[model samples]
Target: MGLGLGFELLKTEGAARRGRLTTAHGAVETPAFMPVGTVGTVKGMLPGSVRETGAQILLGNTYHLMLRPTAERVAQFGGLHRFMNWNGPILTDSGGFQVMSLSDLRTLDEDGVTFKSHLDGRRHRLTPERSMRIQHLLDSNVTMCLDECTPFPATHEVAEKSMRLSMRWARRSRDAFVERPGYGLFGIVQGGVYPDLRAESVEALTGIGFDGYAVGGLAVGEGQQMMFDVLDFTTPLMPADRPRYLMGVGRPSDLIGAVRRGIDMFDCVMPTRSGRTGQAFVRRGVLNMRNARHAHDTRPLDEECRCPACRDYTRGYLHHLFRAGEMLGPMLLTWHNLTYYQDLMAELRRAIEEGCFERRAAELEAGLALGDLPAVPDPLAGPVAAPPVPEESSSVPVDL
Candidate 1:
């Protein structure tokens, strides 16, 4: 392998591809979904449970980690992997996104962005050099370069200016990165929605060189079609041998679409976030537990699913827990959602290997549109008893 982040294309069907990426922790299957562990944890799920969901890598936020445990502390404790007790690879953002998104107030310059922290209103500075330093201290397997995440709905001029500034920062980030075996620095390509600017951004970053490339700035409120259009042109311009990561994107359909456009990696908060809100993802489609229609439903979220949420609980139980604001609601749903995503990734990899990705993609899209199970019988409206739980399974509630 070239380093911690290296791509090897195994199969291809048109623009779609099947590949493997090597990292210090292990090899991650291509077109994989990396769960967002913003603060060294993937929300409600434990690190072991997260691995059970087939996640080979997890993302950590430089802004949050730096503020909370502080990079120095994390380093002292033996980096993010040992600190979090997770053996899998971890990718740390450049602290640029959080600075732009979470910083209460901020100003940008050639040096970096100066902002007030959202946590305690403490002032801080984040530049390419500082970002590299933080991720290095964390000993992140993959580190992102510090770059301005252009504001949403920007005009052509505004986007261009921001894109150019981020390009300059990319060079500085590369220069500051420590050259070590099995460590990588990724340069983000930002151009908002302009194709020309995106091309220019790519050229600049490629000239500077990086271990990998990420397509940033698309998932910031732009519609799906626009995002796809940007990926259509942008992904091809990136080095084919290196990994192409679509950062902070997206829903299940988005993953499928991006993979169809030749993307090799992805990370997002949709599955975990939706799970916390009592939403379970199934092959058929998304199911919401908040709806009154499932008050006495006996069916599982997906009859075909073999996950804990679907195996041990009925729609009624999940519905009741969600309505009661129970922690189990988030836990079970998060688990199910993650399981579903992992299964989907496995299916995609299989299809790509079988040389039938296009056909499989069509089947998946059509299946998800078929919708959910019918509403259950109401006990008040009719004499119906609650469904019995399986004998071997315990329904004990615990906080995630």
Candidate 2:
């Protein structure tokens, strides 16, 4: 193994953690939210703009990149960060989830998954070794092991079979990974929603060992409660000294819940995807900018947000841009939403460091539960004060 990546746990409040992850490219603060850059881009925003949103890391999709530009071609251009013009740390998924979810005529066996591309009728096979190689070619700072993402509502027998297969593949991935300083491979924990299966999977991964561990097989139609339930039992079993990432997770509330459960990292498409659809995530909840009520509203989307969209544009203007089908609408909203998520992660880290995570989490949940702000407010009013942070004695675990 080359120089191993480092993780420093600075503080913890209950299960919440404040840590730092040092990668080959740079260091990422935890709890952190990595913006998804599927196909080597973060949709409508520039790489520099993404960094301006306070994102220290970005996620690339192996399935998409391998199929389109091809990982080898990306390597010719000197890896994803340079190819995409983003200098931050990049983590690449092993393509297992997308293979199962997006491909057709899929077949899973001991070797790996074989499927026809969703983009075309071309067929391909992805094994653990091949997935690791692809990530390496793309120069990922963090590479994920290829594992089956067990579908929701699976029977115990089915889930067990799937998880066992993933564990076997994980071992192969670990052996295949090329150890390098500041670059690490992560194993995915599968088992659907069963605690015993989850525990078994964790044990298997730990035995094989990787640089990091990811909680997979959740957020795939399983409700938030069940997801949280899984995290409750699963996270503690993971190596406490390493980073714990929850893959393809979630709404803003989901991030908070997972962080409180000891997860240090998360990546999701909700913020950017929603932004493209005229949705904005704010401290108080989601705002649909397409609503008629905003046609004449001059207020910023969220007065507290410092993103250009909020600082320089009004709700009415955003509504007009969306209605007119302007590309700038998605660009601005994506930037704003990404900023909001990063800001939330920063606040969570601060609260954990301060030993007030429980109190801070309560205030966040209460704010989100209030839903989007009312259609009208006093023009001169400031952003609403977050509900008081509960006293330590009065604080309780936030219910998702």
Off by over 4 Å in 1: 1-4, 102-104, 383-400
Taking the tens digit of each residue's C-alpha lDDT, what string does model 2 give over 136-185?
A: 99999999999988998999999999999999999999899999999999
- Candidates' C-alpha lDDT: 0.88, 0.92
What's each prediction's clash count? 0, 0
State the lDDT of candidate 1 residue by residue for 47-107, as single tens digits: 9999888889899999999889899999999999999989988889888987888634888
**Estimated TM-score per prediction?**
0.93, 0.93
